[model samples]
Structures are given as C-alpha cells and as structure tokens.
Target: MQLTDRQNNIIAIVKNNEPISSQNIAKELGLSRTAIRSDLSLLTMLELLDAKPKVGYYLKKGKKLTNIDDLLEKPVSEFMSSPVSVEENQSIYDTTIKLFMEDVGTVFVTDTEEELTGIISRKDLLKMSIGHGNLKKTPVSLAMTRMPNIISVKKNEKFIDVLEKIVDNEIDSLPVIDNKKIVGRVSKTILLQTIMNIAKKF
Candidate 1:
C-alpha cells in the first residue's frame, strides 16, 4: 500500500526503535491514541507490522533470493526465535489447544529435565486422530515424532540453510538445538516476518 509522508515517518520511528507500544507512538508523534492505533492496525493488516502482544509491534523484515543466499552464509541466530519450550506428556488435546491459543504451529516436547524427546504439530495430532481414530486414550508420546533423527537448526546456522531444510524436507519448522536440547522452534511464519522486516528497508 502507498504510504503517506506521515505514515512513512511513523514507520521510520518504529524501524529505529521497534517493539514500541501504541501509547508510546501516540505520545511521541503527538497524535491521538486512536490515530496511532488506526495507523498500526492498517499497517499490520498490510503485513508491514508484527505485534508480539506484550512485546509490542515490530517492523516486518523481507529478503530477496540474494538476501536469502547471503543469510544462509551468515549466522542463524540472527533471526532465530528465543528459547521457549513446553513439557512432554502434556496431552495432545491440551497441547493442541495451547498451540492454537499461542498461535504457534509446533511446540517442542521435552522431558522432566527439559531434554528434547520429540516434536509435535497440529497436523500430527490431526493425522493421528483421523487414522487411529482415538485421542482420548493416546498420549502425546504416541503421536509425537521421536528425536535423534528430528530435524534441527543450530543458533549459528543461516536462514538459507534452514529454508533448504524446510522446503526440501516439506516440514513446517525446525527445533533450534544446543547440546541435544530444544531451545526454540523456527517456523515459516517467523521466516516470513523476517522477510517483511527486510522489505521495510524500502
């Protein structure tokens, strides 16, 4: 969408100091909160912004094939998700609800000591339910894909490398690992957002 000079200015401010709240933007721009919110909503709908709830909004990053190539040659942690994990044995039903509620497609399955055991996805649960036809009696472990061979990305890996893994493997995400433990998940959504962030450079 075409942006007005004022809108461009707002984007610039956010780019410089992102994760700033609507109220803060309103005060800084000397505009009404309603106006700021309107701008933010429009920008977000346009996919030019991303809000992390309590973390506020950030400029979406975008990248080209060349950029992706360069990214693959760089460190992965540059855009990796922060470590966030959930325990294993958390029923598939509950886990499904949690994934939807959290707006994440996958969650790492960990043991009591937080060691990675498996990876679970909404699709995995759906497949299990549709085929085995029973979830009430099935544990997440039964539906989870075991580890040791689970795909993963290191914090220092690059986006291109991760992209190759995802596209070539037809998987939605890769768990970020360190010392054989899952620290986070890298999904297509996060990759898209990182690309949007790069686009804002225009």
Candidate 2:
C-alpha cells in the first residue's frame, strides 16, 4: 500500500480538483496522460478515487480512511515475515555469515530437533568478535540468549500487543512461535512500514 511520490501527488491533485480529467492532472504535474494512466487506475482500485464514463476522476466519498487503532488490533500472523535461523551448534563465524546473507538484525537459534532454543543478534556476534577468539571454533550457543529469557510472540497475538513488547523490551525483533517452533519473525521495520502504509491513507 506504500505509494510512490508521483502517486501521492496524483491523489492530492485529484482531491483538490474533483471531477478533474486525467489529461489536466498530467498537465498539472508536467507529465502525459498516458504516463499517469496506471496511477489513476491504481488509485481507483484502492478506493481512494473513483471515475465516471464521461467525467474524469474524483476522490471517493463514503469510504473511511484507515483507522490506526483498528489496524493494530489485527493479528501478527498477517504481517510477520519468514524467520532467518541458525542451528545452535553452528559456528559463530558461520552464523555471522548467515546473518549478513539474510540481511536481518537478529537470527533465531534452533536445536537438532529444529525447535526454537535461543536467539542471537548482530550485537551478540560483534561482542564475541571483540575477544579475538577463534570464531570458527566457538559454537553459537555460547553467545545466544537462551529460551525463557528470549522475548517472543505467538502468530495469533495482536499486533498492538507485539508492538508493546517490542517497545518495552527495547528489542529489534521477536520470533513468532507455534508449539515451541519458530514460524516467523516480526521486526521493528515491518511494524513501522505497516504503520506508514496506513498513515499514507490519511
């Protein structure tokens, strides 16, 4: 739902000048009607705008803007992303590589049974590296924040509840658990993006 800058501009133009033609909107933005054809179509599809046969485009009435409180009450399962995990016995060096390759702030640690056991963060790896110890020989379990100590969430948990935990714990991400197994991860970045997407509708 994140709109491009041009899309936002188009919405603004259409809002201020109701029943405005696509040709005029494009001219106002110094573009061609063909160039904004897709933008108009998308805005209409999102119900932010509406069109008529002979008329042009106008802001859609009667549709309520997104309510942030209601949005946060939705389940985390709807927004969680696939988790990036490493085995507990994985070497610190290899696990660090996995973190970089995954481009994630934290990595979940799993046992031989593939159940969640612990969690590791980029900060944890960096702290271990300062010792100048042999990372290849050191196991990731040595640096992980073990279960019962790790902050986590369930898939059905409310988004607002997860947001509260993240803010209270000062953590970057939480592993989504189901029957003790990691199913997904909800991160600060994802939460912020979701909120921004809703905010743009206003």
Most lDDT-accurate candidate: 2
* Residue pairs of candidate 2 with colliding backbone atoms: none
User: Top model by TM-score, which number?
Assistant: 2
lDDT of 1 at 69: 43
RMSD of 2: 10.0
Which regions of candidate 2 are displaced past 4 Å? 1-66
TM-scores of the models, in the order given: 0.61, 0.69
How many residue pairs clash in all the candidates, one count each?
A: 14, 0
Question: Could you tell me the lDDT of residue 150 within candidate 1?
Answer: 83
* Model 2 residue 194 distance off true place after TM-score fit, in angstroms: 0.5
Q: What value does the lDDT take at residue 128 in candidate 2?
A: 99
Per-residue accuracy of model 2 over 100-193 as CA lDDT, tens digit each: 9999999999999989999999999999999979999999999999988999999999999999999999999999999999999999999999
